[model samples]
Target: MVPGLPLKNTQASTGDTFEAAVLAGLSRRPRAIPAKFLYDAQGSALFDAICELPEYYLTRTEITILRDRAPEIAALAGPGRQLIEFGSGSSVKTRLLLDSLEAVAAYVPIDISGEHLEATSRRLRADYPALAIVPVCADYTDLPMLPWLPGSSGAAKLGFFPGSTIGNLDPDEALAFLRNARRLLGPGGALVLGADLKKDPGMLHAAYNDSAGVTAAFSLNLLARMNRELGASFDLEGFAHEAFYNPAAGRIEIYIRSLRPQSVRIAGQRFFFDAGERVHTEYSYKYDLADMDALAVPAGFVRTQTWTDPGRLFSVNYFVAT
Candidate 1:
């Protein structure tokens, strides 16, 4: 079981804010909610399941690259650096870097899901007893600053942002995030970023529209979350999960569409939906080396090295803040 925030408490703690967000999102045209809210304990568990599905090649492919290139990555990052991960999740891929880095100063895993972060931190502490482990619970994108790494004033900071989570942000938001990250990492710091490469649209569609329907469940859970936390009367049966690759946009667009006309009440406000009306859920953008450079350069990072799998399905890049 995940530690720290319990399900009931998680719901309670985020209730007011979530209610406000839900109301605001519904108030807007072409309704949408931030993707970060999708990772409640239950949703996080579902996503872990999605990663294991046969069609989901991203997780396994990235892991293979990390496994093969960790030593080389460590060499680039050098010795006694403080490691920080954004959207740390289970911190599964971190093991490769932790084992390879020489005399690491500390490990900090920042995540929005308190339960997930706490549980992962506990396991990591047990496994790597000597290393300092600090887990910060916050939305990494909006986080103002990180906690100070004790006794490591002069140590380099290496940011680990695997899993292509950066792709969820729009281009402007992504550039802003990269800029914020550059400031946080400071001079002499480095980042290891994972990006999904553009590929056959059929393969991309298959990845999101999995055969087992786990992705569908994941997308629909947003509604269930509202019902539980925001006193929203959302009929799960009324909506259907839809996802497809938008090649022109170079991203996967996900949404929950109303199967039929329906009215839902939340926080004493009723909203009507027309048949087939949709609420945007998330976007996963694919990037090539040039696109990566475009993003990193203006953010004050210079790409030092990049590693990709045999198929070039994904890229792991090392960038230094200048």
Candidate 2:
């Protein structure tokens, strides 16, 4: 559970904003949707279920690494740091780091879902009373400045972007985000990030297409949200979940393909879908340690250390601002 009271909510888009974004994404030639939009309350809950699925090794593998190596990660990161975590859903994994860090001044957890963040933050505050908990309800990607921390001055800035979420952004967008984090952390600050490593295609495919169908429900929730918020006329049953590893791209491509010919409307605009036409939803890009290091250099960070599990399914990397 999240501890502490809610921080001043950071500004985010309104319901109408969802309408415009849907219009734009659907207007594209290939019809792609940003992964960010799939985190509405229902979608977020389904994702939590997806994490627990047996085939999804990401959460379990990464947790084992943090459970064992967090103390080492914190020692190199040093003390009296203000921890800022991006995409901190549920914040369950954050407990490992919070426990290991010596003297964290405050914890600022940023997420896209305002309602979800509030509940998580409330419970977290109960657990760690001495720690300042500032939950910002905003998309961390576009955030220009962080909210005020009650006693945040004089602490080293420690940025945490875990969950291999950096893979969600396109390479250019990821670079921009890296640069932004460098600026946010400033000199002498450091960042710890989790990345999914390139593995056998079979493992990757199974992780996305679990037997219990939670992932399918999670993918389909996007349509449920669109219909609710944007007045979209999408028949959720008409679509089927499709996720597969793309060797050429070194990523897992997830799409919701139309099972039959259909038409849908959102905010008065209509879109026609042919049988088997796909609405591309997400891409989980896999990376090697060297590829990550190459990205860090141009973003003003120097790769410090990286730890991988025995099975080598995932990695936790630490980088310092140069």
lDDT per residue for candidate 1 within 1-322, as digits (tens), equals 1122211122335556667888988889999988988998888889999989999999999999999999999999889898989889889999999999998888888887888878888888888878888788777887788776557767889999999998999899999999999988888999999999999999999999999899999999999998887788999999999999998999999999999999999999999999999999899999999999999999999998999999999999999998
The local distance difference test score of each candidate is 0.88, 0.88
Q: Which stretches of candidate 2 lie over 4 Å from their true place?
A: 1-5
Task: Write down the TM-score for model 2.
Answer: 0.97
Deviation in angstroms for 40 in model 2?
1.1
Backbone Cα, N, C clashes tallied per candidate: 0, 7
Q: Estimate each model's TM-score.
A: 0.95, 0.97
Alpha-carbon RMSD, each predicted model: 3.4, 1.9
Count steric clashes of candidate 1: 0
